[model samples]
Target: ASPADMAHIAAANPAAVQGLLADLEAMAQELLAYRADSSLDTAGATIRAQAARIAELERDAARYRAMRDGLVSGDLENNPIGEAMYELGERVCRERGHDAIPTAAEFDAAIDTAMKQPTCTCPSGDGSLSWPCPQHPPEVT
Candidate 1:
């Protein structure tokens, strides 16, 4: 209705106008409540996602720590190759400082390269057989 018509009706029936206003106010309050509930639902989902990500990160960190410890202690597989690699890693760390500890991927690559090298039967001048054939040492690249 036009403003003029509404004003005329309101003046003629003030009680009806008051009732409509009350209904409109209640509808506005309900809409506000619904909006607040929707926002809370969205926030809850975000919090859940972040919590899951944190848990995943914690698991990854634990696995990495275990791998690092195994590699450093030469107890990963209790084999010759593992012992050689651990000794080599220790020597490198001693020479280059602890900050030079290789990541798991780098260590794996080095092991793969060492395994691919041909074995040598000839003993060194010191009467000891070193890893990676000694004569044809695995390239560091």
Candidate 2:
């Protein structure tokens, strides 16, 4: 409604627009800096997470090695027992004319029979008893 007001606004409009543009430029620069900083932070977090994962994998590998060694040792210690079981299975197969690989029931029965049979303490070595009974250790050959 006022001519004087309109004239003043027209005179200041260019300078005001320039100031706004300068402010926008500054804000853009800040945004770029913030992006660079945030990317570095993200990279650090990723590296730390990966390192922890690698450590966990190493620990798991160690445990697996230990378990494998224990199983091998147990198998070694029990080999004689397994051999005895196989021997009994073989004798039954040969005498009865059955398959060499005995069934589970036959295997169990052979094991039970072997356990129940008398184990002679003599050094004859024919029985399943330990050689050189505690009472009479054989003279060292």
Candidate 3:
């Protein structure tokens, strides 16, 4: 019950009211002590970390949602340029006509695999590829 209801009951029963008021006072003291002992700084740090992780998870969720929607709707198939490119790549690949067409998953996996590999074959070989080298980019070697 609310404080107002309790107050009314206490007014009608003095002994019972006194006991209830005493209990409330004891509870308030305990709450204050707990508040004083709690570490606000530690709580703030934990809250910040949790918020950052939630934001990162939200971004990953959006990425997966886009991938799922793309697969279900075949938005790539509807684009004329994309369709032409797909047909061109299919023609270039030396596969049998009866072979299965590569899905978006296969294309994504291939691109990811390629991105993880070294780009240049020329081994001046500092374990680093030359960017805009004299033989490469004509403007800024």
Candidate topping lDDT:
1
The parts of candidate 3 lying over 4 Å away from their true place are 1-38, 78-141
- lDDT string for model 1 (49-97, tens) is 9999999777556545645665678655654456657776897798889
User: Which has the greatest TM-score?
Assistant: 1
Q: After superposition, how far is residue 68 of candidate 1 from its true place, in Å?
A: 1.2
Please estimate how well model 2 matches the true structure, expressed as its whole-model Cα lDDT.
0.67
Model 1 segments more than 4 A misplaced? 1-7, 10-12, 79-141
What stretches of model 2 exceed 4 Å from their correct place? 1-13, 73-141
lDDT of 3: 0.60
Deviation in Å, model 1, residue 56 alpha carbon: 0.9
Worst 10 residues of 3 by lDDT: 110-119
Order candidates by lDDT, high to low: 1, 2, 3
